[model samples]
Target: MTVLKGARERWVRTGGTELCVAELGDPGRPVVVLVHGYPDSKEVWSEVAVRLADRFHVVLYDVRGHGRSSAPRPLRGGFTLEKLTDDFLAVVDAVSPDRPVHLVGHDWGSVQSWEFVTVERTKGRIASFTSMSGPSLDHFGHWINKRLTRPTPRRVGQLLGQGAKSWYVYLLHTPALPELAWRGPLGKRWPAILRRVEDVPGDGYPTSSLPSDAANGAWLYRDNVRTRLRRPRPDAHAHVPVQLITPLGDKFLSERLYDELEQWVPRLTRRTLSAKHWVPRTRPDRIASWITEFVTAVEVTGEPEPRATGRHAERFGGQLVLVTGAGSGIGRATAFAFAEAGARVIAVDRDPESAASTAGTARLIGAPEAWAETVDVSDEREMEKLAAKVHAEYGVLDVLVNNAGVGLSGSFFDTTSDDWRRVLDVNLWGVIHGCRLFGGRMAERGQGGHIVNTASAAAFQPSRVLPAYSTSKAAVLMLSACLRAELAGQGIGVTAICPGLVNTNITATATFVGVDAAEERRRQKRATRAYGLRNYPPEKVADAILRAVARNEAVVPVTPEARGAHALSRFAPRALRALARLQPPV
Candidate 1:
């Protein structure tokens, strides 16, 4: 039988509003709220909710005036933020009863969720929030439009830039236009437009089921954007744990909108979907499994797992190990780990001071010689010069660790051309440059050396939110694999090291496309690092790298999570995808 709760939808009263909500799964379990987008209702999430019910108390809801809910007329003062937010609270209170709910929203639903989480009264009512195709309203503007691959079509985007490019909005504002449109050719156009904005075009949804409700639901546009906010509480907002998911081809909003959200919310996870705007239906299983994993990752309180202990026979007496982005995190740890093993280290970093610090530590650890150099990995000429110098001074490169990289936040379209180029250059091309310049010499000697190319969990798969970063890492992975196969006969070992959630400072080295020179400089000066929850120390990653070199492993995945990801890479692509989606993008 079709789950009764799946369509067991209704409206509930709380304070001055009555809002619609749909129930699914076990009400006794941890409550989760699923909110859909414009021209869609709670039913959009029905299939996803049914799949999630095994572990969660799922609540799928239509926003006011959508689905089977009451489409109340605008009050005398009209629709406002306070009113809409009030409606959100009413839905949660009714569905979740006394407890806080895990909230997930897509499109306009995400807009409402963002507002609700920012407000004092309802903020605490939420356990954690996941924003799909949305970010903080204040910061989204920059990340989306900066260096998008295709600039919005001038006619549509610019016309809409003035106010609205959507006829649905005209209907929503014209009182009866939407209802009439849904009954006519306009309704046929709705799904097409939504598909363009969402990513999955005519993927798998029944748009004909409720034409009238679909059209009338478009009224939310007029309701939220037209009317002024009823109340403002400047101090009411606080950063709650937030996860943002953006699709790469989402025509409506670019991923760049989320770049600064990490700054606003201290605890934030960001992800990208290689999808269209209609995310829930397009990648339902992946999205649902990710929700289950994220909601359940509670912190363990007792003793931490003991660190691994081992012995290696490899000698690092004078092998020069060049590490990049070495100021902090795994890169630093990797550099220090090599030094401790008796390698003559060349600690290279974008920051001279950071390089100096690593050199100082290496010296303290009894390294015969620890050289610090400041060079931008993205600069080809600089990298070339550095490699030549290393060959002249050290004579042999036992290991060349390409560990420099930058982080990009928000959607794929959020990045500018410059942003894309810079990330790709550093994360992908840096390794290429390092290997080409250094590997050739090692091969020429016939003695052989090892190359560890640092990639991320994101490397095996692409992320919706990080277009540039993911693209770069993916290229790096393929390149390393190609190199490994081709160079096997030469006795030179090539290893791709995919690390999961190691703490590092990557955001600081990133630059925005088209930013003013002064502004870019200012950004660089005050760059802050983005972090992950399950942070692994840098030394751990360094140890993994060294071990991989010794074992002649093709791919040295650092964490158990990375190992799991590698396993899933072939045996279970779908389940692996779901597991991969558990972590945020940026």
Candidate 2:
């Protein structure tokens, strides 16, 4: 009984063993063959395959000695890379005889598929390769050799880190002990272990054949790992376009393993995920989406997906990002920044037309997908509904920017309670709603994400004319700091971005408390003029926001004045307090 429902299952014979192959989608469409890793079977790709089935001829297969596939007699020499390659070719030939197939693999499957894509014999047969959580044994061998021979401090540290992560690989190579454990308590508890440690959903996966699969698949390491790592082939370069999806939180593999990989893969597109290993199960939607994007791009252009040219493109590419107040100024600039990095952008703002305009331009810049969502961040009900819709439609956000805010001006004595409420509602409470609603979803997803809250220089630099606005922003800054401390354990980073007097439309719309309508308009014009003289663009502040998220900075103060104020508030609070008494011209 296969775990994959509605899949057409067949058996392909190779090297005196039978392999279980399952496929879905139209045969005439481009073929996408998914290979499973060790200690598992074809069922591992069930989630990803179903998603890709609509767009491709999705294929999955159990490697020899796993699942329903018959184990080779004397498993010692049975599961060699050469044999696995043969099994892959047999499946490909059986399914898509004349046409080349897009190849995707995870873990051990990725390991074997590396052999498939690199070897000359199967060059023309493989159109493209997408790898996750696995490295080519050959490249890995060279990586180890390079570090061992040179031994720099950073290199040695990376070696040590990866050595610790590969403890299970060492254990797997041990004799009948691994087999005995897998056949007994370890097999029964494996599913629970995956759920607890990796946050893999407790769906009915791994199937009932886990014990036999684990026991038999032990030969994958026995036959290949030692020999390949010790005497790795130098010519094991990938002939096909490669898309490498590295799991940042993979316990068994270090991110540094793929350093300088460009030398081996000529056309490489790298992506990172803040997830534990077994991404196929945990991040199926993302995985499927990336694969579809890569395959479609390749099919249409007859080449790998063109790499995004933006800074941190590798970090944010294909990641889902939601930005509030994306209608204009800093919010719109931030949205464009993420879009330029190839992130999927959700341009959210209270202004429907402006949001839609931002979203449209975002797509043109570089975002793979962009959408407009109109919602007032201060309105809790509207925010709640927006969160629900975003999660349901767009999946969990990889980055959230609570950038929506309003400005207010007037002395504390003159500022009415209504003025304070208005400022707080749009600034502090808006950030609160965004974090509670969307940040909650990010945490619940269990995968790491980033939250950026738009604060202001007035948060740290006190001023007499902007009492209400300063209080709201000060609250936002404090809130961000507190949330950063709380969400740190969950791998979610919270940042407070304080921008000082950027040239934007906020000042024009800012309310002047305790002033007549004519006086308010005059003040707005004067303030706007003063800001225009400074002439700092919102794009610079937007760049700071992206950099802050990337570096996971605690509090980022944009512009020279903001940074100066931040420094003063930290080390010379008395001077800052003394300066707070001065009256502004505006």
Candidate 3:
């Protein structure tokens, strides 16, 4: 029995071979056909297929000589790209004879589907293509030829790096030995290898046909790899929209292999995943989401949805990010930044309406999903409840931004104990609660994540007037550093973001301690005016936060003055101290 639970199965015959095809979802809906890779059957797509069944007509078929599909008499020349394309056409024609089908492929399936979409015979049959962990053999050949012809030091290095990753390809091309290995110990240990290295779940996948599948699938590389790479077709450009999903941690393929992919795919949307090569098995939710989005866009508009017009969109798309204090100012900007990069956003604020407003706008921008939560970060019980709710509702966070903080200004002598508690409660203690609860869950999951804490330039360049505020932010800075050291081994990155002054409403709501209410208002106005004169935007700080997470930086000084203060604190402490002691005009 196949692993796909509720599938309607049938057999299609083409060119002396019979393919086992499974259909899920309503037959009248737009069709989505999933093709499996080498050494595996259509069961590879079982998880992804079930997820998309609600919205589309989902189809999965075993390639010739794998799974329940019957093999050719001579496996040597039988698994060529031409034969694979014939098999694909037969399956689609049987499923949907009138309308074109959205095509998705992984590994060797993607390699052959590249031929299906690019060749003239099957051009009208495929409406769109979503490719993962595979490149068109023709494009790859052209890449190699160009690099070898006009070689630079960087190009030479790229060639060498990819060559090293292709060590398995060399081994697969060898005769008889691969079959012997597969029939012997390798076949039995294959499932364990997938579990340990790829983190694939033991769900009775690969079926009981493991040894036969492995032995027959070896011909996939031998039959097509050498022939395609040597005399590649020049007119192999795709006729439909292409979505390329690359796994950054794939041990067998370098990211640079797609450097010149734009020339081959005119309308290309690039996505990247942090997981290993087996994303269909490990990250099925993300894979299914991307495919659904891409297929729907093409169905509606005949092109890919307007691509995310933000920095690092490829790296951040489909990831879940949570931002604290997102009602306004820096927190709101950070949430919108992640949203623009196609991340699903959770906006947390003390105010309900404001958080809801941000989430609504995030969806309008580019986020596929967005939600708002009202919580006072200073309250431990509330934070605990919020963490539990978030984990249950949204799954593990890929990124967490702790940007909630209050501003306070007064002489050290005038700032009393209550003021100290208030400042520390929201700034320092809030960060602590977020990291302890949410971060604990992230670590327990053991998949890797990032945490960002918003400190201030006043942390290092302290001011006498900002005694309580400075103490709280300084504590946050140190806490981020210590936590970064602790979480480094688990692959979680921690960053402390410091900003000198950016134009936001924090100054308006800031407290002027040791003064009358009337005087406090006057001082607040003065401070807001001064910061407004600096004319910095909170969006820039948001960009810095995303960049820090992407690069795994320890400390980031966002503004020019913040960078200067950080440099002076390191190289010239006395000068920074002197500047901190001066009285403000207000």
Using lDDT, give the best candidate's number.
3
lDDT per residue, candidate 3, 1-586, as tens digits? 5479889999999999999999999999999999999788899999899989999999999899998999998898999899998999999999999999999999998999999999999968999999999999999999999989999999999999999999989999998999999999999999999888887778887688878988999999999998989999999999999999998889888899999999999999999877788888877877898999999999999998877778879989888999999989999999999999999999999999999999999999989899999999999999999999999999888899999999999998898899899999999999999999989988876666899999999889988798899899899999999999999766689999999899999999999998999999999899899989998999999999999998789999989999999999999999999998899886
What's the best-to-worst order under TM-score? 2, 3, 1
lDDT of 2 by residue, 151-186 (tens): 999999999999998999899988899999999999
lDDT of candidates 1 onward, in order: 0.67, 0.91, 0.92
Query: After TM-score superposition, what is the CA distance of residue 299 in candidate 3 from its true location, in Å?
Result: 2.3
Which candidate number would show the highest TM-score if scored against the true structure? Answer: 2
Summing lDDT over every window of 10 consecutive residues in candidate 2, give the lowest-scoring window: 304-313
Ranking by lDDT: 3, 2, 1
Stretches > 4 Å off in candidate 1: 1-11, 14-20, 74-79, 136-179, 188-204, 207-210, 226-238, 298-586
Model 1 TM-score relative to the real fold: 0.46
TM-score-wise, the better of 1 and 3 is: 3
Poorest 10 consecutive residues by lDDT, candidate 3: 441-450
Off by over 4 Å in 3: 1-3, 184-208, 318-320, 356-372, 380-398, 409-417, 432-449, 458-471, 474-494, 512-526, 560-586
